[model samples]
Target: MTSTPQERLRLVGREEATPAAMSWVMSLDDSDSPRDIIDALGLAPFVSGEHPHALSAELERVKPDAALCPEDARILRTSDDESTKTVLAAGEGWMLRVLRRTNGTAMLHVSAVTEELARTVIEVCSKDATVAEEADDTQVSMGFWHSGAHGFSRRERTIGAATWPEIEQNYSGDISAALGRLMALRAEDVSGRLLLLHGPPGTGKTSALRALAREWAQWCQVDCVLDPEVLFSNPGYLMEVAIGVDTYDDSKRKWRLLVLEDCDELIRGSAKESTGQGLSRLLNLTDGMLGQGRDVLVAITTNENLSRLHPAVVRPGRCLAQLEVGRLSPAEATAWLDRELGDRPKPAVEAGGMTLAELIEARDHPTRIQAAPADTTAVGSYL
Candidate 1:
């Protein structure tokens, strides 16, 4: 049966697609043209002999009925009898292309896509929306004497490798001390220490933060910032959603364990004066604002020396107790292996002086790893 625009859209929103439907649809704004879309999506130039057209032609040859439809306002379908059809529709200064397959699998493919994809398509297909929703979401954060920056949505919950027991086993003494401080945060008698974990690249700083996040998530909201660049593009918007910081109209549930990973990027000490502004604002949010009530727990990870951070960040009242997170100690290394390989230390016996992050990368997941039961309401919770 031929699919209408609504049917096609419904397929795009679904979780399954037929093999023939395993295709990509790209919609570009006025800021995006055919050439720009090609570059953005990493497609080869149409002019090159070994280019995009070659692939499309190959698709056509395999299915004689396959064809390309001309660009138009309404959804266009190709007249060719090929197994697949490339339909192009342009409107309100934007372009939309859908590759429709004859087989049942098209529905399956569209169904498996992410919400970001669905949202992007909807926005692009709507009248005159210019923002492209497919921009890279992986955020990188760095700070001087602080944790790194990370980009994350307020609504999404991220899973990580470490857990409470893992953190306790590795950094027992430090974790114990942190726990005391964290518990004290409830009283408002003592200010909480912003755990400033610093170490070498590939060190367990980020891993430790993830572990810390999982550990404290059960008790308080954990709002982590994994990217710093977002601050540069939209400082006001960034602050509105930044960890431990709330706006005039924020809800009570925003209290969190604010984890800022790789904060050194913002205050690396070599950049321009403007960089300090974000760091200053971040510090204020962590301590100055949240410090009064002690309702927030701030964890910042960095590779830079704490002594080098700007005064706005490292002052005594701001982040007094800085903890150094390095490669796992000898005891930590052995214990970690014991946890992963229960009775047998097969990999650990052979491996030497590797961080948990390194070991995780070296081994395949769902092997030494067992999947934890999915959290039902985890998406909206503090974790």
Candidate 2:
């Protein structure tokens, strides 16, 4: 049994204290065992916050023979560099590893094991560097920041207020009209659970997500699931985000929207055959029955073809909306270009079937970008 001896006991401003308080303070006790001290103090055993299983609350294991609250778990990790070759060069404690989706890896220093500390460890390991520039606490946190230990971050993000209008101007006609109808939804009218936004690169997927954040700011807290790949593989990491045990600014918001950006394989065909249980977990989250009672909406963006998506994952009722952020039409592209060169013999340069992103780059360059870089295999592409 652990013990800390007390030679003397004193209380300041004891004038108003009760007789029992005075009696407790007056006892100059010797060392007491941890159990005796806990019993005397009437403190409950510490619990770990990383809820095992889906939402099970049972205390499965204890760390270090006792639990330490978050405030008590000292900060021992500083360097984010995950490479073992770098050598952290710091003292060791009960450390946990979290692999974030977008942000750098996270190292959690646990002084003692308890639920709060485990949750804190996941959070600390998952937290992205806070917004560098001054933006509102909510808006400033708008983007991906992964924790290496957690695989992906359950990081919250909502784009700044001023940027959405400017981003809207980038799209005209069909794309613009399609988005307008959805944005016009009344507070009580929203019925869908999953939003599938599929498109290729340079089609303004990131910007579109930002706009959605702005559109739903009044009712929803936008949370980014930074690492979709790891999200399926790691149950502990996935549960924290799925359960959303800890949410930001929940007082004002009625719902939370989770973003699984650039997740091609999670929704693609053969997902169950190849990707394992992650795809199933994702589909379950969007299910009408399975997703009941949870105030959350999932928005996923991918670069895969619309036809190739998994049939079960994209069933009619499961998805609230399926909007494609595809290449801009010729007329739309011309209109965008016309914004810069209004009515002065606009340079005609074969702009058919080009993405807005490609057009923007072409306008800036003296010549076109090199032929798609020879289609060489790069790291991190889904098969």
Clashes of each: 45, 24
Q: Which residue ranges in model 2 land beyond 4 Å of their true spot?
A: 1-140, 143-147, 150-164, 245-250, 288-290, 343-351, 366-383
Candidate 1 residue spans exceeding 4 A from truth:
1-29, 32-153, 158-162, 172-193, 242-254, 269-276, 287-298, 335-354, 358-383
Best by lDDT: 2
lDDT of 1 by residue, 284-348 (tens): 55666524554665677778886666655566775635666555665666666776667644454
Per-residue lDDT of candidate 2, residues 255-285 (tens digit): 7678888888888997888889978888767
Candidate 1 local lDDT, residue 229: 50
Q: What is the TM-score of each candidate against the true structure?
A: 0.45, 0.58
